[model samples]
Target: MRVGDVFLKVDADQARIEVEAMALAPVPTPKVLWRKPPVLAIAAVPGTALGRLGEPSTASPAAWAAAGAAIRKLHDAPLPPWPGRGLDELAADLDGECEWLVTNGVLPADLVTRNRQVAEAALRPWTPVFTHGTDVDLDVIRAWSSLRSLLGVRWLVEHGFDPTAPGCEVDVLRSRM
Candidate 1:
C-alpha cells in the first residue's frame, strides 16, 4: 500500500504467485504474469483489496486529473530485478492447476468475490469514462507501466531475488502536480 511496496497472492507451496493487476477498466485485479519465462508479476492484490475509491465528480476536475496523473507516475516506476515465473511457467510448475481454491474448498464463493473485486478495480479509473470531458493520455500509460514494474518487483522477491541493493530501488514514480 505504500508508494513502492508490491502486493501479491502466492500458493501454499509458494510455487505460483499471481500479481494483482487491472485488466482494463472496472475489472477486478486479476493474476496476470508480465513475463513469460519467469511468470513474474506484482503480488496478487491484498485480500479485501480496494484501489482508489470515489467518483471524479466528487472532486474537482483538476483534482481528479491530478489524482489520475499521480497514479500514472506511480505505475511508471522502474522495476527491480528478480527471478520470476511467467503465468504459464507458474502453471506448469504447479502442474497447470492451482490447488489454492480446492485446498480451501470454498472456490465458489471465492470466484464470486473475485468477480466483484475485478469489477471494483476496473471501476476505479473508469468512473470518469462516461462523464463530460473525460479523456485519456500518456499518463495512463505511465500508471500502467508503474503497475508493471511493481509486478516485476513482486516476482523478484517471491523467487528470492533481492532488489534492495544500492541503485536498485524503484524508479519512474515521480510527482503529479
Candidate 2:
C-alpha cells in the first residue's frame, strides 16, 4: 500500500499500539509503512472516516452497510491476547473517579451513585476484542450510530441485519450488556 504523505507525530509507545491495533482489525485500516521514534508513517484509507462526531454524514447508505459489515467481522474475530481491562476493572475505575468527583464536590454523591447503578449494565463479563482504546472506540461507535440513525432500524431490517439481535452491528461486542 502507498503510504500517505501525511505524517503523525505521536509517542513511540502509542504509535506501536496504534500499529498493532490496526494490524489486528478485521476491517480495513491504514497500513503502517515505517516508524521513527515519534513519527509513524501510514497509508491513508481509501475514504475519509464515515463521519466525525456531531457532523452530518455525506456517505451513502451503502457505505454505512459496509461499515456495519466490517464492524461485525471485527467483532466476530478471535479476541486479542491482551487482557486490556475487564468490565469489573472498568467499573471500579469509574467508581473511583466518581468517588473523587463526589469528594471534590464536583458532583453530588447521590448523582454519582445513581450513575453507577445505571452503569451496571456495562459491568458484565465480556470477551475483549481489539481496540485502539476508549476515545477511538467512541468515535467508531459515534460514526456507526450516526449512520444507523440516518437509515433507522427499518433499513437494517430490510437489509437483513438484525437490529434487535445479539452480535449485530448494533451490538458491537455487547458493550451495553
Candidate 3:
C-alpha cells in the first residue's frame, strides 16, 4: 500500500516487526479552524458475515429462517480485554462531534433537533462483545443494520423484484412475505 509515494512493501522477513504505519510529515502549527477532522480510510469489510449469502436456493421458508438464526449465533459467540474506558470515551467523543457538526453548519439548521436526538443516542454507552483482533470492535449497530439490509436485498433479488423497477416475481415475493 502506497500513501503519498511511501510504498509499503510487506514480506515474510518483516512480518513479525511493524504492526502499524504512520505518515511522516511536519506537524501543523495551531492551524485548526472550523473544518472537520479527517477520517482515516478503513478499507472496510462488511461488519457481519450475514451478507455473504450470495444466493437464495429453491429451499423451504424454514431454511432461510434457520440461516438467520445461525448468523445471530455466530455474532453472539464470545472471545477477551473488553475495553470499557475506550467505549465510553468514544461515545462521548462522538457526542462532541455531533455538536461540532451543528456548530459548523454541516447541515440544515432545522436538522439540529434530529442531530440532538442522535447526539443523545451517541452518548449512550454499550456493552462490548469479545472477539478476535486487538482493535476496538466498533460499529456493532451499523454492522447488524448492514447485514439486515443485505438480507432484504437478497430477498428482493431472490424471487426477482427489480429493486430499481417493477416485476411480477417481486410482487409475488412481497405478497407472500
Candidate 4:
C-alpha cells in the first residue's frame, strides 16, 4: 500500500486474511479497491496515527475511549471459524522455536532452554479475537480512531452521500447486538 511517498508491502496471504477478517469487524477498515495476488489496492482512511512509541498522543480523550469501545465491540463478536491453539500446542511451538534457534547457533543452548522454561510457566488459556498479530502502535491507534469516526458512516451510505468524505460526514452506526 502506498501512503504518499512511502510504499508499504503486505504479504499476499496475510492481506487476504486481513481483508476477510475486516469483513466481519465492527470497526471501520480501509476500503479494498482491488486485489491482484501480491498487490492489494485500498483507499487510505483519513486521520493521523494515535502516537509513536515514545511520543505523546495528540488525539482527544474521547477518541481514545472510542477506540477502546470499538475494541470491545470486536471482542464481543463471534469467534472466527478457525480453531485456536491450546496451551500444549503453544508450548510445543515455543519448544520447537527454541530448539531451532539453538541448532542454528542463534543463541546459547542454556539461555534458550532457561527462557523456554520460564515462558512455559506463563503459558495459560486466552480468549482469541481477530488480531493482525502486530503490535498496537501509532498507526494502529490511528486506524482505530478512523474506524470510530466511520462507525456511523452507514448513515451516509443510506442517505446517498459519499461515505468516504473526510469532512462534512457524520456517521451513526447503531449496533444491533
Candidate 5:
C-alpha cells in the first residue's frame, strides 16, 4: 500500500527477505523507513513503473538496458546467507503444482502441459545467485510466472479477484501461448 511518498509492504515472510536483500544488494533499492513483523515501510522511488504486466512497455530502450544492468549487478553480488531451493526440489514443486492445476480444473490440461514443458528447461543445474526465489534463466522466468499464476488462481478467486481480468495473470499466460 502506498501513502504519499511511502510504500508499506505487509508480509511476514517477504518482509524479512526484502530487508535482508536490500541490505545486501549493491544496486539501488527502496530506502527502509521502518519495519515491524508483517509490515515494512519504505520511501517510494521517484519514477513511474517501467511497465505493467500484460501491457506494452513505454519505457525507452535506455531504461530497459539500465534495468537489465541492475539485474546483472544483482546476479553478480555475493550469495545471500540463506539458501534457495535446489533443482530437484523446484522440479517437484512445479510438477506437483501443474498436477494440482489440472486436477482441480484451475487451468486447461493443455495449457498446464505446455507451460510445464517450458518450465522443464529451468530444471537443469545452474550456479546459485542472490535472487528473490525465481531462477535467473529467461526460460525459468517464464516458467515461474506460469507456475505462480497457476498457484494463485484459486487464492485470487477466493479473495474476490477475477483471474480472467485484463492484464491479470491468466491473461498474461494466455498471451504468452
Candidate 6:
C-alpha cells in the first residue's frame, strides 16, 4: 500500500527478507524508510514496472540488457545467510504441482509430463547465490518458467487474471510442447 512517497509492505518474514536483500543486493532497490514488525515502509524507486506477466514488454532492448547485467551482478554477490530451497524439496513440489495440474485437468497430461521431464534437468546440485530463485541453464530456466506458470494458474484465476490469454502462461506451456 502506498502512503505518500512511501510504500508499506505487510508481512513479517517477507519484510525481513526484503530488508536484508535490499541491503545486500548490488542492484538498486527501494530505500527503506522505516520498519515496524509486519510493516515495512520504503521510499518509491524511480522507473515504471517492466511489464505484466501475460503482456508484451515495452522496455527497450537496452533496458532488458541492463536488467540482465544487474541480475548477473546479483548472482555474483555473496550468498545470504539464509538457505534457499533444497533440490529434493523443489523437485517434490514440482512433481506435486504437476500432478495436481494434470489430475484436475488444469493443463494437458502430455504437457505436464513433458514439462516435468524438462524440469528434471534443473533438479541437480548447484552452488547457492543471492537470487530470487533462478538458474543459469537455459533448459533449467524453461523448466522453472513452466513450473511457475503451472503453480500460478490457480492463483491468477482467483485474482481475475486470464491464464489462457494469448501471451499468458497457458500459451507459454503450449508453445514449449
Please list the C-alpha lDDT of all candidates, in the order they appear: 0.36, 0.50, 0.34, 0.49, 0.70, 0.71
lDDT, candidate 1, equals 0.36
lDDT of 4 by residue, 1-177 (tens): 244533232332332335576787878877877665544567766777675433578988888877777777776777667665466755565556556656766445664554454453335454466653234444434333333323223333444545333322121111100
Q: Which stretches of candidate 2 lie over 4 Å from their true place?
A: 1-19, 30-59, 107-114, 129-177
TM-score of the candidate numbered 4? 0.46
Write model 6 residue lDDT over 1-177, tens digit each, in one string: 445577765432342337886788878888888887656789987877676655788998888888888888887888767776677877787777788788878888998887777767667886666763444578767876776666556655555656787656787777678
TM per candidate comes to: 0.27, 0.45, 0.33, 0.46, 0.69, 0.64
- Clashes per candidate (backbone, < 3 Å): 28, 0, 0, 3, 0, 0
Q: Please report the candidate that would top TM-score against the real structure.
A: 5
What tens-digit string does per-residue lDDT give for candidate 1 at 1-177? 222445333333333232322333232343553534444345454443222322223445676665565456434533323343444443243321223323444234443233323223222333232112224555444443333333344444556755343322133221111
Report the Cα RMSD per candidate: 14.9, 13.9, 16.5, 15.5, 4.7, 5.9
Candidate 2 lDDT tens digits, 77-155: 7765555545565556556655665676644566445445545544555435653232344444443332222223333
Compare candidates 1 and 2 on lDDT and give the better one.
2
Tens digits of per-residue lDDT for model 5, 1-177? 456798765433342337887888999899999986556889999887798876788999999888888888887789878866677766776777778778988788888787777666667776666753324457777766666565456555555657787666677567557
Which candidate do you rate higher for lDDT, 3 or 4?
A: 4
TM-score of 2: 0.45
Tell me the tens digit of each residue's lDDT in model 3 across 1-177. Answer: 223322222222232112221111122112112221111222233222233223445655676676555445434555222223354654454455445545665433444344334334334565544222234344433333222222233333443433323322222223222
Rank the models by TM-score, top first.
Answer: 5, 6, 4, 2, 3, 1
Q: Which ten-residue region of model 5 has the weakest summed lDDT? A: 8-17
Better of 2 and 4 by lDDT: 2
Question: Can you tell me which runs of candidate 4 are displaced by over 4 Å?
Answer: 1-18, 31-45, 102-122, 129-177
Runs in model 3 deviating more than 4 A are 1-67, 84-88, 130-177
